[model samples]
Target: MLAAVGALIIVFPILLLLLNAFKSPVDYANSSPLDFPAALDFTGIQTFWETQNFPRALWNSIFISTMVAVIAVVVSVLNSFAIGIGRVRGRTWIVLAFLMANLVPQEMLFDPLFQLYDDLGLLSNPWSVILTFVVIQSAFGTYLLSSLLGTFPKEILEAAAVDGATRWRTLRSAIVPILRPTLSVLMVFFFIWTWNEFLLPLAFLNTSDSLTVPLLLEQLNGERQTDTTTLIAGTLISVIPTIIFFLLFQRTLTRGITAGAVK
Candidate 1:
C-alpha cells in the first residue's frame, strides 16, 4: 500500500496533465487537483492537433530521438568494448573525463552549444538536434555500458580469439548478444530523454516546422492561453509516445538495471 501510494505520488503530475487535457480552463482552475474532468472536452485536442502542426512535430521528435538512440548505442558499445575488453591505455582517464562531463550541468553548456551550432549553420536542422542528443547521452551510455562490460567474462573473449575470431567479430557476435538487455534499457532511456528534451531544441531551433513536441506545447501555452484545455491536451499528446516506450521496455529495463547492479 505504501509503495502504491508512493508510485501514485510520483505519477501525480502526469495524472493531473491527463485530467487537465480534458478540462476547460475554468474547470481546471475551479476544481480540486484530484477531481475528474467535468466532461470529455476533446475540442482542445482537435485544436491542438490542427493549430500546433502536431503531426509534423511528432515526426520530427520521432526521427531525432531514433537517430540519437541508434548513434548513442553504437558509439557507447564501441567505446565500452575498447575500455573494458581491449585494455586500452588511458581508459581510466577517458572514463573519468566522461564522468566529469556528465557532472557538468547541461544548462552551463547550452549557450556554447547554441553558439557552436549557429556558427555551423545547423540551427533548426533535425540532424543538429539529433547530434546534440547523441553527444549529451553518449557520456552516460559509455559509463553504463563500460561498467557492465567490466563484468563480462574476459576468458570467453580470449577463447574466441583462440578460435580465429577477430576482436571486432568477437565483440559483434559474442559480446553484443550478452549486452542486449543493457542495450535495450539504454535505447529506451535515450529515446525518452531525446524525445522529451526541451531546452536545447528551444534554444537552437527557431523555425516552427523544426519545433519538437515539447517546444510545440510551450508555444501552445504561450499563444493559446485562453484555451488551457487545448494546452493540456497538447501536453498529453506529447507524453503518449514516452509512456508507450516505457511500457514496452519496462521489464527489460528493470532486469538490466538489476543485472548491472549485481555485477
Candidate 2:
C-alpha cells in the first residue's frame, strides 16, 4: 500500500543509520551497506562521545531549546491574547507584520543580529541563540495562535467577563487550560526546531566549549579522516534527544492536533 511504502521510505534511512552505527569501519568498508555487520562495535560511539564532549553539547542544546520553547510560547500567548481577545487597535497590521517577519529568511537577518549580539557581548553566549529564536519562533507562533484564538468560542470569553475575571485571571484560569494542548504542540515544535539549528549556533557559539549537538555533528562531518561509521554514530546520537522528547510529548501533540478537528 502507499502508506506502507511511505513508512518504509521514512524509516529506511533511520534503519541504515542504526545499522551503520554498530558497524566497525572495516566491516562497513568491506560489505554492502545493506549487509549486516560482522560484529557490533561501540568504538565509534565511545570515540565520538569522548572526543566531542557530547555531554556538554547535549546540555547546551537542551538549555537553548528549552529556553526558546518556554519563552516563545509565553510571548506568543500574550501577543495572541491582545490581538485576538482584546481586539487591540491595529491588530490586523500587527498580525501582518508578524507574518512578514516569518517570511523574512533567517539568513538575511543573521548579519545584523550577529553584529547586535556582538555589541551586546552575547557572542558565544547561549542566550544569543535563545533570544534570537524566541523572537523568530514566536512570530510564527503568534500568527498561528492568533488565528486559532480568533475562532475560539466567544461565549466562553463573555462568560468569563460576566464572572468578573480579570484579563490575567481569565488567561491563567481559562484560556491557557483550554489551549494547553495547542501550547504543548508549539513547545515541542520550538524545542525541536531550536535543537536542530546550526547556522545561528555556529555564528554565535563560536567556541568549541559552547558548540551544540548540530554543530558537533557538522564538525564530525567535516573531518575528512573521520571514520564513516563514527560520523554516522555521531549523527545517530544527535537525534536521540529529539526523538525522546517527541515521544514524551507524543500524546499531547496528537491531542493538540486533533482538538481543533473535534471542536
Candidate 3:
C-alpha cells in the first residue's frame, strides 16, 4: 500500500505533463492542467516537430549517450573484474579513488575541460561529451560492479583456470557471460545519465549541429509565453525514446539490481 501510494505520488506529475501535452492551446490556458484533454489536439506536437526539428537533437543525444554508455560499461567491467574478482593489490585504494572522484561535481570539471578542449579544437565535438560521460559514469559503474563481481562463483573461475584458460580467455568465455544482465542494467543507467545530462552539453555544445534534446528543450521552455502547448509537447517527446529503452531493458535491469542487492 505504501509503495503503491509512493509510486502514484511520483508518477502523478509525469502523468499530468503527458495528459496536458495533448490539450489544445486554448484548453491549456483555460482549463486546469490536471484535467484530461477534452480532445487530443496534436497541432502543438506537430508544430513543435516542424519548428524544433527534433530529429537532430534526438540523434545527438542518442549517439553521445550510446557511445558513453557502451564505453563506460566495457571499461567498468574490466576494472571491476580486476579489482573485485582478481583481488589486485591496492584494489581498495582504487575503489576509494573512484568513489571520491564522484564527489567532485561536474560543474567544476567542465570549465577547465572546455578550455582544454578549446585549445585542442575539440570543443563542441561529440567525442568531448562522450569521453566526459564515459569517465564520469565509469567510476560509478566500476564501483557498483565491483561488489557484484565479488559475488562471482570462485569454483567456476578455478575450473576455468584448471583447464588452462588465460585471464582474457576466462573473462571472455566465462565471466562476461555471467555478468551480462548486470552489464545491461549498468548500460541502461549510463545511457539515461548521459542522455539526460545538461551542463556539459549546454556549456560546450554551441553549434545547432551539436545541440541535444535537453538544450533544445531548455530553449523551447524559456519561450513560455509562446505556444506553451508546443513546449509541453516537446518536453514529453524528449522522454519517449528513453521510456521505450527502459521498458525494453527493464527485465535485465531488475535482475541486475536485485542481484547486486542480495548478499
Candidate 4:
C-alpha cells in the first residue's frame, strides 16, 4: 500500500512524460499537465520520429550496446575464470584493484580517452564508443563473474577434469552453463547502460551519422522549446527498447540480484 504510493511518487514524473506524448500541443499547454489527453493521438509522436532521424539513432544505439555487451561478456568470462578458478597467487590484489577502478568517476576518464582516440584517429568512430562502453563495463562484469565462479562447487570442475577436460574446456562447458543467470544480469545491464549513456557519446561522437538515441534526444530538446510534447514522444520511443530488453531478461536479473542475499 505504502510501497505502491511511494512507487507512484517516484515515477509520476515519468508517467507525465508518457501521457504528454499523445497530447496535442494546445491540450498539452492548456490542460492540467497531469491530465489524460482529450483524444488518444499519435500525430505528435509520428512527426517527432519522422523529423528526428530517430531510426538511425536507434540503430546506432543497438549496435553500440550489443557490441559492448558481447565484448565485455566474453572478456569478463575468460578473465574471471583465470583469476577465480586458476587462483593465481596475486588474484586478490588484482580483484581489489579492479573494484577500486570501478570507483573512479567515468567523467574523469573521458578526456584522456578522447585524446587517445584522437591520436589514434578514432574520433567520430563507432568503435570509439563501443570500446569505451566495453572498458567501462568490463571491470564490474569481471568482479561479478569472478565472485560467482570462485564459489561454484569444486566437484563439478573436478568431474569435468576427470573426464579429460582441459581448463578452458571446463570453463566453457561447465562453468559457463552454471553462470548464465549472473551473465545475463551483466549482459542486460551493459546493454541498457550503454544505450542510455550520454556523456561519453556526446564527448566523442561529433557527427549525426554516429549519434545515439540519448544524444539525439538531447539535440531535439535543445533545438526547440515548444516541442515539449514532441520531446516527450521521443523519450517514450527511446525507452521502448530498454523496457523490452529488461522484460526479456527479468527472470535472470531477479535471480542474479537475489542470489547472494542469503550468503
Candidate 5:
C-alpha cells in the first residue's frame, strides 16, 4: 500500500499533464485543476508539432543520449573490470576518488568545461555534449559496476583461469554474461540522465540545431502564450520516451538494485 501510494504520488503529475495536453486551450484555462477534460483536443499536440520543430530536437536528443550511454557503459565496464577482475594496485583509492568526484555538484564543472570547450571549438557541437556527459556519468557508472563486480564469485574466474584460459578469454566467456542485467540497468540510467539533462546543454549549446528536447521544452514555455494546452502537450511529448524507457528496462533496473543490495 505504501509503495502504491508512492507510485500514485509520482504518477499523478504525469497523468494530469497528459489530460491537460488533450484539453482545448479555453478548457484548460477555464477548468478546475481537478476537473477532467470535456473532450480530447489534439489541437495542443498539432500546434506543438507545428511550432516546436520537435522532430529535430527529438533526433538530436536520441543521438546524444545513445552516444553518452554507449561511451559511459563501455568505459565503466573496462574500469570496473580492471579494479575488480584485474585486482589493480591501489584500486580502492581510485574507486574512492571516483566516488568523491561523483559527490561534487555537476554544475560546478560547467564553467571550466565551457571555457575548455570554447578553446577547443566544441561549443554548440553534439560531440561537446556527448563527451561532457561521458565524463560526468563515468564516475557513478564505474562505482555501480565495480560494486556489482565485487559480488561476483572469484572462484568461477579462478576455475576458468586454471583451465589455461587467458584473462581476456575468461572475461569474455565468464564475466560479461553475468553482468548483462546490471549493464542494462546502467544503460537505462545513463539514457535517462542524458536525455533529461538540461543545464549542461543549455550552458554549452548556443545553436538551435544542437538544442535537445529539454531545451526545446524550455523554449516552448516562451512560445506558448495563450495556448497553455500546447505547453502541456509539449511536456507530455517530452515525458513519453522516458516512461517508455523505464517500462522497457524496469525488470533489469529492479534486479540490478537488488543485486547491489545483496553485495
Candidate 6:
C-alpha cells in the first residue's frame, strides 16, 4: 500500500505535465486540469521551440552538464585517492571540510562568486557556471567516494605494491576498475543535477547567447501574461533529455546502488 502511494506521488505530476502539454488553451481555460482535453494541441510545443531558439539552450545545457560531470568525477577521484587510500594526514579533517562545503547554501555563495567572477572577467563565460558546479558537486562526490574508499581492501594495495606498481598505477589498474560502477552512478547524478541548476546559472548566464534550458524555461514563464500550457510544454521538453539519460544508465545505476549492499 505504501509502495503504491509512493509510486502515485512520483507519477502524478508527470501525468499532469503530459496532460497540460497537449491540452488546448481554450479547453484548459474552460475545463478542469483533471479533465481530458477535447482535442490535443501542438501550439505550446511549437511556440516554445521556435520562439525560444531551443537548440542553443539545449546545447548549452548539454555542454555544461557533461563537462561538470566528467571534470567533477575526475576531481573527486583524485581527492578521494589522497584522503581514503593515501592515508593522508588530517584525513578526517579534509573529509569534514568537504562535507561543510557541500552543506554551505548556494544562496550564500552567490554574491561572493558573482563578485569573484566579475573581477576575473569570467562572468560572461559559460565556464564560470561549469567550473562553479564542478567545485560544488565535487565536494559531495569526494565525500561519498572517500568514505567508500576508506573501506577498500588493504590486501589489494599490498599486492599491487609487491608487484612493483606505483601509486598512480595501483589507482589506475586496481582501484578505478573496482569503483567503475559507483563512478558511473555519480556521472549520471552530476549530469542531471547540473542540468537542473538554476540560481547560479541565472546569476552568471544572463545573456541570451549563453542561456541554459532552465534559464530559457524561466523566460517562458514570461514577464507579463503567462501561457500555462506553453510553460508546461517547455518543462516537458527540458526533462526529456534527462529522462532519456537516466534510462540509458539505469542498469549501471542499479548496479552501483546495490554494489556494497549484499556484502
Q: Which candidate is the best by lDDT?
A: 2
lDDT tens digits by residue: candidate 1, 1-263: 99999999999999888867887667777998578889876788888777778889889988999999999999999989888777689999999987776787768878998889989999999988888778778888899888778888978888898999998899989999988877878887788878888877888878999988888878877783547777778888888977887788888767756865684
**Candidate 2 TM-score, true structure as reference:** 0.89
Error of 2 at 132 (Å): 0.9
TM-score of each: 0.86, 0.89, 0.86, 0.89, 0.86, 0.88
Deviation from native of the Cα of residue 176 in model 1, angstroms = 1.5
lDDT (tens digit, per residue) of candidate 2 on 11-80: 8998889888888888888998888878989888888887788999889998999999999999999999
> Which candidate number maximizes TM-score?
2
Encode model 5's per-residue lDDT on 80-148: one tens digit a residue.
989877779999999998887678776888899999999999999999999988877887888887877
Candidate 4 collision pairs: none
* Per-candidate local distance difference test: 0.83, 0.88, 0.86, 0.85, 0.84, 0.87
**Model 4: worst 10 consecutive residues (lDDT sum):** 253-262
Worst 10 residues of 5 by lDDT: 219-228
lDDT winner, 3 or 4: 3
- Off by more than 4 A, model 2: 251-263
Model 6, position 178, has a per-residue lDDT of 98
Candidate 1: which pairs clash?
none
Provide the clash count, candidate 2: 0
Instruction: Compose the digit string of candidate 3's lDDT tens values, residues 1-263.
Output: 99999999998877977989988899898998878898989978998998886999889998999999999999898899899888899999999998875788878888899998899888888988888889889998899889877888999899999999999999999998988876878888788888888888888888877889899888788775658888788889987887798888877767766865786
Candidate 3, residue 61: how far the Cα is off, in Å: 1.6
Candidate 1, residue 158: CA error in Å? 2.2
Clashing pairs counted in every model: 0, 0, 0, 0, 0, 0
**Candidate 2, run of 10 with poorest lDDT:** 254-263
The alpha-carbon lDDT assigned to residue 5 of candidate 2 equals 98
Error of 4 at 133 (Å): 2.1
Compute the lDDT of residue 134 as modeled in candidate 5.
89
lDDT (Cα, 0-100) at 83 in candidate 6: 93
